[model samples]
Target: MMSSTFLVMRERVVAAIMSNPVVGPDSAGTLARMNDPSQNCTFEELGFDSLARMEFCIFLETEFGISLSSGEIEASPSINAMAAYLAGEG
Candidate 1:
């Protein structure tokens, strides 16, 4: 089972992804796939190229008030991994 904190973090991450112009409406299906806890969806798998990853990193820093280096983002590419990272940071 996932912790409530993790679940909340996951939702925030998904919201950030959805808010990206690059990931707008057309990526709805990819977003849906991301919501699945059973799957480990990486940035690449979700169609987030280099620029999208940078955007996502900026989103996380702005929304979560946490700094993440490109290396950190690369190290934790999946939403679940990012959520776990946030949990650890908290």
Candidate 2:
């Protein structure tokens, strides 16, 4: 069973991914996959280029008020992983 905090963080992470201009609102297919909690989508699978990766990291740092490096984000690599890590950091 998942905790409420982790669930909230997961939703926030998905929301951030959707809202990022780099991800673009037009990628509806990828967005849908991301919304499904059962799926484990990697940033690379979502077509997150280097620039988008940096933008995502910046968005996360600003949104969550936590310092995060690309290395840390890379270590996480999926919505669930990122959310779980951030839940602890938050």
Candidate 3:
């Protein structure tokens, strides 16, 4: 089971992805898919190349006030895993 904190962070993480210009386009279809909780996709599945990953890391650092390496993000690739990892960090 996921903690409340994890669940909330998961939503925020999804929101972050949706807001990412490189990873997510401003398309309704993409937003709909992103909103679907069942669609827990890895960064690769979301078409994240090295540049996108680095940009997202910068975004995360700015948004969460926490520094994370690309390797760390790659390790916890999915939203759920990332959220859990972040919740633990908190």
Q: Put down candidate 1 lDDT per residue, 1-90, tens digits, no spaces.
A: 788888888887777777766753356576567777655567667677777777877887888886777677778787889877877743
Off by over 4 Å in 3: 25-33, 36-39
Q: What does candidate 2's lDDT look like per residue over 1-90, in tens digits?
A: 677787888887787677778874346676777777766577767667767778787777788776777787788888888888888943
lDDT per residue (tens digit) for residues 1-90 in model 3: 557887777787887787677877446766665666655667777888777878877887788776888898888987767887888943
Decoy 2 TM-score against native: 0.78
Give lDDT per model, in order. Answer: 0.73, 0.75, 0.75
The residue-level lDDT of candidate 3 at 68 comes to 80
lDDT leaderboard ranking: 3, 2, 1
What lDDT does candidate 2 reach at residue 81?
88
Per-residue lDDT of 49 in model 2: 71
Q: How far off is model 3, as Cα RMSD?
A: 2.8
Per-residue lDDT of 76 in model 3 = 91
